[model samples]
Target: MSALVARPFRLLGEGAVRAVRTALMQAVSAWTADWGLAPALVDVDVHRAWDGTSARALAWNHGAQSNGRRAWLAVGPDVATGLQQMMFPADPSYGPVGSATPALAAAGALQALDALLDALLRTSLSSQHNVPRCGAAVPATSWEYGSGALVARLAFGSRHFHVLLDGPAVQALVPPAAPLPALRAVDVAAGVADVPVSLRLQAGTARVGVGALLSLAPGDVIRLDKQADAPLTLASMSSHPLFHAYLGRCRDEVAVELVQSHTPVGEVQ
Candidate 1:
């Protein structure tokens, strides 16, 4: 029902878009943390409205595999200005931090942030995620501000920046994230097997009289009201039920054959 709805990459599933947003947030947080700022990830939202004069966009080809496919990531003025203030001190004299203009601040801040993001992409994010960035520092004079722009709002405290990318740009750069935790399950399974397992055979239970407990001595037989067909419960050291089994013998050794899966009360599995 909006113009951004008509954009190309908006059709990319939430996972892909979320991965891109997460990468941006990580870059932003790392950049801020280096400056000694305790930035928190607040929210990431898709926005169609854009009201800013400063923007920095880069067009890059994703190598030969993409047949020279080009895409861009644009930054809005409000966001850039916010980052500039948060990143450096607000010196009115323009001494150490440079100028005070939003256009200049946004451009410079974005350029610096781009370098940090590049390093992150090389390290944690990598090519599998497919995020994009420009080679050199983008000048403030290069920004183009207009409408119909798709923006992503990365909010941290009072900081807010819009990542402007066309639908096609996102679809090209963003890669599909693995659908699961995606670690080495085989290693995990092998380690899990080595862990010690314990079993319990609570044949039956009774609320006996205190006199009966005190009278226990050698050569005394205590009869428990247990049916022979009743199953025994297998449990972990932590007392978590693993399975239900029936009493039996495997040739020479006594055994309790598993009969059914066990689920604790209020637990689905």
Candidate 2:
């Protein structure tokens, strides 16, 4: 006779699930701030299924009901092994009270999830290695609550993020490509306009022959062809010239200024 080996099972209780949702909201706030994303309004709650399955969902609401705008981002678990799921409402009939008209750019939900996940990784957070594949499915009707269209599945620790389209939505827009690493709230100041810039293409004279040979001396000087007052160039990830300013200290922290604009990064001009 052979004995079967049993595995330990852990289930989330009502109190524990509620606490987890609350913690997730805090995590979301930190993630947006760290990634320079327009912070999202977070709402977390616990949902249960009649079949004894229950889980918590994190909802990022973006829409207003008065203007027919409706869009939301929801992540929770269904009536199964407590895996995670993402749902997007495409129809407007069943909309949230203050939801804004959904926008096309909101389709970047997949990317947004990636940004949030990356932030989690940077913060050294561990997730269960049970992330499933991402996929989407469309519900039969707009008025049917909890109905949606699935787009695709994303891979998390053991769960995947799926995209769904059911209504108009707004997206957390990324700041236009800039020269500096990122734009900060303190970047905006009196007499300064926040713009993007990059120094990649700004032509710089390179050492060819004598400039290279003169470097052999211990105290040799190799002067750059550009003038010292020629607004020192700054760079972002794009082509636009953000702002030209010298670094300064504010409240014991280093800061920059948008002194002038040459060319807008990521823009035709």
Candidate 3:
């Protein structure tokens, strides 16, 4: 008995796919805008391999890197036709201006396709960090496909077209990951040595009715809730208590002597 095994294939990461889609959309938008056309990206997909079924495709050979890595771009027939119609809109009164019109339209479409490919290459290569520099493009007689490729669908009005990339091109569009910086031990005290912070001391607190507060005279005194001999709180600017202190006189100036550490609730002794 013979058993069949599924072949394993490598696919682009989600980030790479997203980057390719964005680059395509930007390139298409820029190209179409130059020709006074507005187009929207409909979808993007990655295929394991080209079926070699699409005929009359306009292709170009482009390098994704200076190290002889080659890639190919192909515009489907429908896309070429769409580009022709878009670049040369016919008047209804004239209605099919003759056989020469198709020839002219095809020529114009070819030029547009070349420009579009240039724009795509520029967008894909320039937008990424750590990506290898690409070389100039040349006219390709045929397309070579490998394990994977990318296909992006774009729509202008009701018409839709496809842009295809070979495996190398898809791989080229993916940027290399940037290396992370190495971690080293830092001096905790030295790092914050220059930072300024404010400390405060709390003598005591008193409560009184609003009426009594408003009726206070020049000599009026409010009794505090704490006893006179009780230690005051040494706190941060935000009033978070840090230590207990006792009132004292230092060089004819009133001061507080830190008596004990103030442990906050839920902390170990």
Question: Highest TM-score: which candidate?
Answer: 3
| Candidate 1: worst-modelled 10 consecutive residues by lDDT | 59-68
For residues 1-269, what per-residue lDDT tens digits would candidate 1 score against the true structure? Answer: 66554322233445655655666666667766765666563366653323343333333212111222322333334555566666665777755336544566667777766664353343232344535555433223223233223345656557654444443334444675558865654655556657665666777766778998899899987776777787777776566777889888999998888888787544422
Kindly give the stretch of ten consecutive residues in candidate 3 with the minimal lDDT sum: 138-147
Among all windows of ten consecutive residues in candidate 2, which has the lowest summed lDDT? 167-176
Q: After superposition, how far is residue 172 of candidate 2 from its true place, in Å?
A: 31
Tens digit of per-residue lDDT, candidate 2, span 1-269: 89996532223245433433344445567755754543443333332211121111223222112122222233444311111123242565756458774443344554556555443322112222312222222223322333221121223334433222222211111122347666565733432545543444232454659767856778866677766556555565664555576555589886655587666564444
List lDDT for all candidates, in order: 0.52, 0.38, 0.61
Q: Which parts of model 1 are misplaced by more than 4 Å?
A: 1-10, 41-43, 47-69, 76-80, 88-151, 155-159, 165-269
Pick by TM-score: 2 or 3, better one: 3
Residue 21 alpha-carbon offset, candidate 2, angstroms = 1.7
